[model samples]
Target: MALEKYSTVLKMAQEGRYCVPAFNTYNYETIAWAIEVAEEEKRPVIVQLYPGYDFYIPLKVMCDAAKELAAHASVPVCVHLDHSATYEIAFAGLAAGFPSVMIDGSSLSFDENVALTAAVSRAAHALGCEVEAELGHVGSGSNLDDFATGGKFTDPDEAVKFIELTNVDALAVSIGNAHGAYAATPNLQLDLLSKINDAVDIPLVLHGGSDIPDEQIKQAITRGIAKVNIATEYFRAMYKGYSASIAAAPDKDSLFEISQMSKDSVKEFLRGKFNLLKADV
Candidate 1:
């Protein structure tokens, strides 16, 4: 499939009993590994980058990499901006040929959030890009330090209002999810998620999905969670791979071995997710 708006991919997940993995990337090697696994499994995945990551690797390079990966990959890939805090970055992402972009105005007041998100939605749609916006604050980790907020749940009624006002293609609800690796297992607000799901017609996204039990993840997907954001687990695997590589070779570090090890580690996690989601190649 050609590169398309995330709305189409997200809709497919809802109707098909699956959830698309929106994987975060930093370097070219990580992005390459993600695309390789997605292509090998023939699963639709979103390559998501954030504002902080934009400094490490310019947005232009990332989008170009994503475009090239999508253009030639065997399966489907969508390039997206993960947590855009302001309209300027959102507009930059739209102009960079991203197929989807997220506007995270959850830190703002309800009215301001709606207004800013509406503006972003308009700009993104005009460029043929899908827009995803957050309803409630999801805490920070994985370099999302500014996104942190205490345990707050999105009001189902307010979610409906936000959607109506913003006209976003997808909604990312807080629902007790956070940004980084949890110190303990997170208590996912399944009931709250279901209420929001029932309130809105658009696809729902779950952020900070790392460390959640597989059963809970599956339940979220079945109950209308179309997109799941995963970052910490991927970082964990990379750290594990490098640590093992260093332990095995006390003298020298093989860059190739390190890259392949990280790739193998992530592939195992992703393959299981694709299978559980009932994604077919």
Candidate 2:
């Protein structure tokens, strides 16, 4: 098996009426765990690297690691750079061999966001890569106030215009979804998502997949969310594994053993998530 393009996997998800689970990975343990679960479930998965992670894990290193892991996986896997806030970082990810990059200009004005996303799209398309653009602001979930005040649902009409102008392979919508762990359970705006879906033909993406109710997420998939990003839950799963391992055996200090334990925990967590998405083997 080889690393498949993000556009291809997303398309499959879109047509299949199910969303693919995209897990954020910063190191070998996380990346390996995601791919291992995807292989076992026989489902296509996207391994995403956030730009902020570059401080600890270099972009090139993560990209190379994802490519290598995906190359030998039994199921299709795609490498993506998530929420790249700048063109330079997005370009660097593409150059580093990521098949997908997100140009996040959601904070900017509509025109500016369109211009920035369009420029990145042109460059990415030229290199046979896919570009994802965010249309509305998906605020941080840690701040419930921000969730109420900062977030704006994507306008169906604007989504049509933005996708037309940017030529993005996927459009990330903010319809009552935020990033990070939710302070409270989210009530997804599936009707709004349906409107956006009706307006645009490209695949739709949902961020802040951690705490949304499973039924809401399933409804979202039915409405056209083809990709869902999960970060906080995966990170929490790894932390729980580490805590349990140290508590059970305080004297155990083998890095390999600890890493394996952590990976196994994350794999089990992902298996449940994959099943939630109705992923098939």
Give me the overall lDDT of model 1.
0.81
Please list all clashing residue pairs in model 2, or write none if there are none.
none
Clashes of each: 0, 0
Q: What value does the lDDT take at residue 29 in candidate 2?
A: 82
Error of model 2, residue 101, in angstroms = 0.1
Give the Å shift of residue 203 in candidate 2.
0.3
Tens-place lDDT per residue, model 2, 67-115, is: 9989998999999999999899899989988889999999899999999
**Candidate 1 lDDT, 1-281, residue by residue in tens:** 84756888888777777899888887777677777888888778888888678777888889888888788877778888889999998988888777788999998999999999999999888877789999888875433332323346788999999999999999998876778876556667778888999989999998998877777788788778888988888777777877877777767667876666556666777776676654232
Q: Please report the TM-score between candidate 2 and the true structure.
A: 0.96
Output the TM-score of candidate 1.
0.92
